[model samples]
Target: MSTNALPPVVDTDTWQKELAALRIREKAATRELDAIAAQRRRLPMVQMPDYVLEGEHGPVRLAEIFGDHPQLIVYHHMWNDGAEWQCGGCTGFTSQFTRLEGLASFDARFVIVTHGPIGEALAYKRKVGNTMTWYSTANSSFGSDVGAPRDGGFAVNVFLRDGDTVYRTWHTDGRGTEQLSYLFGLIDILPYGRQEVWQDSPAGWPQGPTYSRWLDSDAIAAAYGEPN
Candidate 1:
C-alpha cells in the first residue's frame, strides 16, 4: 500500500478534535436529508393508466400490485432480450433488498418491474437468489411509461394506490437511486469509498473505471456457489 493513499495518522487528541468537527457536519447533513425527505413527502402525484403486467401467477393490473398496501415501491430493472444475465447494477441493487417484511408495517410494498419476459425475469431473479416479487412489462407500456423502457435504463419509482386508482408519486434514476442502496452507502463510508474514478478523492487514492467492480447476477451467483 502506498503511504500517499492512506489517511494521515494523527495523535489521539488531534483525531478526536477532527472527528468532533466532522460529527457536526455529519449531523447537519442528516438534518438536510430529513428536510429533503419532508419535501419529497409533499410532492404531488400523477394518475397512471390501468396497465396490465405479467406476474408470477398471470396477468395482473397495476393497481393490484399494491396488494392491500396503499404505497408501492418499484425498482425498474433494466433488461436485454435473450441475454443470459441482466444488468449488474440493477441485479446487485435489487438483490440487497431480499427481505422487506418491515415495509408491511409502513403500508408500503416493494417489488421489481422489468421489461424482460416474465419467465426470463423470474429465472434471472432465481439465478441471483433475489427473493423480491418481480413483474414483467414486456407486453405493456408500463416500463416505458415509468421511465424504464426496453433497452433503456433502470429507475426507482414510487406509487400510491387509492381504492382502484393508482398514481405515480416519485421517480428517480442514475445516482438519484443511490440513497436506496445500503451497499453504496456502506462503501461510501469506507476510507477508499467506491474507488470509482468519477468520485472526488485525494491525490494518489486508488481509483478505477466507474462500475468496473460491479458483478452481474451470473457472476454473483457463481461466486457464492449458488445454483444457476
Candidate 2:
C-alpha cells in the first residue's frame, strides 16, 4: 500500500518534440488531402441545370454562384424551426466552416443551403456568427431535388458544371461522426478535448450530449442583430 513516486516534470522539451511530430503528421495529412482533391478534380464535368433558385438577391441560377469555377460545394445545413431540438454537432462543424474565407482557391464555391426560411436562416447565421454564404431552400425544390433529408442533417455535395450541364460528383451523408473531417476535430489534438466543452461546463449551465447549447434563438439574434 505505497503510492508511486513522481519524477521531476520535463520542461516541455518532450512536448516540443511531440508538437513537431504533430506538424509533420499534419503535413502528411495535407498531402493526403491533396491526393483526394486530385481524385475529386478528375471527376467528369456536366452542365449544371439552368434552374433558378431564390437567393439573397432573388432568383439566382446555380451557375451564378460558381463564378469562373465549375465546381460547387454545398453544405445542406439543418437549422430547425425552434430551439426545442437542434443538431448541436452541426453547429460545431459550421463554426469551423465560418472561418474559411479563402475557400474560392479550391476552385469551388462553398455555400450553405438551409431548410429554414431566408429570414430565419439569416437569423441563424447571425446567431452562429458564421460568414459562409447561406441560402434558404425553404421555398424551393432544391433540397429534395438534391436529396437533402426532410428532417435535418449535414450533406456535403460536390457538383461540376460545363456549359449548362450539372452533374453530382460526390456526396457524404453521415449525420454526426462524419463531420469530424470538416469540423474542429480534424485539427484538434489538445489534451482538453474536441467537443466536450459544452459538456464539461460548470453547474447551472446548460449541458448536452451535442454542441447545440451554443445555439438558440437568442444566440442567433445576438449574432445576426435581431432578425429583420
Candidate 3:
C-alpha cells in the first residue's frame, strides 16, 4: 500500500482486540528487557584510577563527580575537539537531562563529560539551553578509557565506587544512547516514527534526511562564546 494510505479503520471491538494482542507482545518485550538489565547488574566491573576532570567549579576528581552517591552514570558527549557547535543528535539527547533530583533520590548520579575545554563545554551547554551538570575530560584519559570521545559518537558509562576507588561497570553507545531519550520511545509509537531515511516506514512515507542534519561546524561556531 502507498504510504498515503492510512491504517485500516476498525470497529471498537476489533481495535480493542488488536490492542490487547499488542500489549501481550509489549509485556513480553518488557520482560526480556528486565532480564537483560538483571544480567547487566551482575556483570563484572573493572577498577580505574581516580582521574581528574574539569568542571564548572574547576578541577574535580572522577570520584568527586559522584558526590555522596556510590553509583554514577556519565555520558561521554561528543565535542569534536572543542568545536563552536556540538553534534545535533548528541545535543538533542543531552537536552533531555534536566534536573537529576528524581534520579538522585534513587542513589544514582548522572553527568556529562566532554574532551572539550571546560569553558567551551559550559558555553555550549548554556547556548543549547540545557541544565545538566557538565565536566571536561581535557588532558585526561577518562574519555578514551570508558567513554566515546570522538566526533559523531556518544557513550553512556555506568560506574561503581567502593570507598575511594572507582570501577567501570558497563558502557553503551550509538543507538544505545536512545535509551535515555524518551523522545525516541514516544516517536516509535507514532505513525511516521522518526521519518528517517533508513527507518522501516511504509513506502513513500515522507522519509527525510537521517539525524545528521541537526548540527555542523557552522552551528557550533554560532553557539560558542567566551566566559564572562
Q: Scored by CA lDDT, what does every candidate get?
A: 0.90, 0.65, 0.81
**Residue 171 of model 2: what lDDT?**
72
lDDT of 2 by residue, 1-228 (tens): 425233335669987887798899899998998998799668764444566656776767776767678778888876677654345556555666545556667776878887777776766666666677788777777776676764756677778877666777877777433643553454245333333444453333333355533455345435543344
User: What lDDT is obtained when candidate 3 is compared to the true structure?
Assistant: 0.81
Distance (Å) between predicted and true CA of 37, model 1? 0.6
Winning model by TM-score: 1
Off by over 4 Å in 2: 1-32, 45-48, 82-86, 98-101, 175-187, 195-228
Pairwise TM-score winner, candidates 1 and 3: 1
- Candidate 1 residue-wise lDDT, 86-196, digit = tens: 788888888788679999999999999998889998888778888899999989999898888787899999999999999999999999999998998899889899899
What is the lDDT ranking, best to worst?
Answer: 1, 3, 2
User: Candidate 1 at 172: error in angstroms?
Assistant: 0.3
Model 2 steric clash pairs? 46-165, 47-164, 47-165, 47-166, 48-164, 48-165, 48-166, 88-212, 126-224, 127-220
Q: Root-mean-square deviation of each candidate, in angstroms? A: 1.5, 6.5, 3.5
Ranking by TM-score: 1, 3, 2
Per-residue lDDT of 13-47 in model 3, one digit per residue for the tens? 99999999999999999999999999998999999
Model 1, residue 192: distance off in Å is 1.1
RMSD (CA, Å), candidate 3 to true, equals 3.5
Residue pairs clashing, model 3: 84-220, 85-220
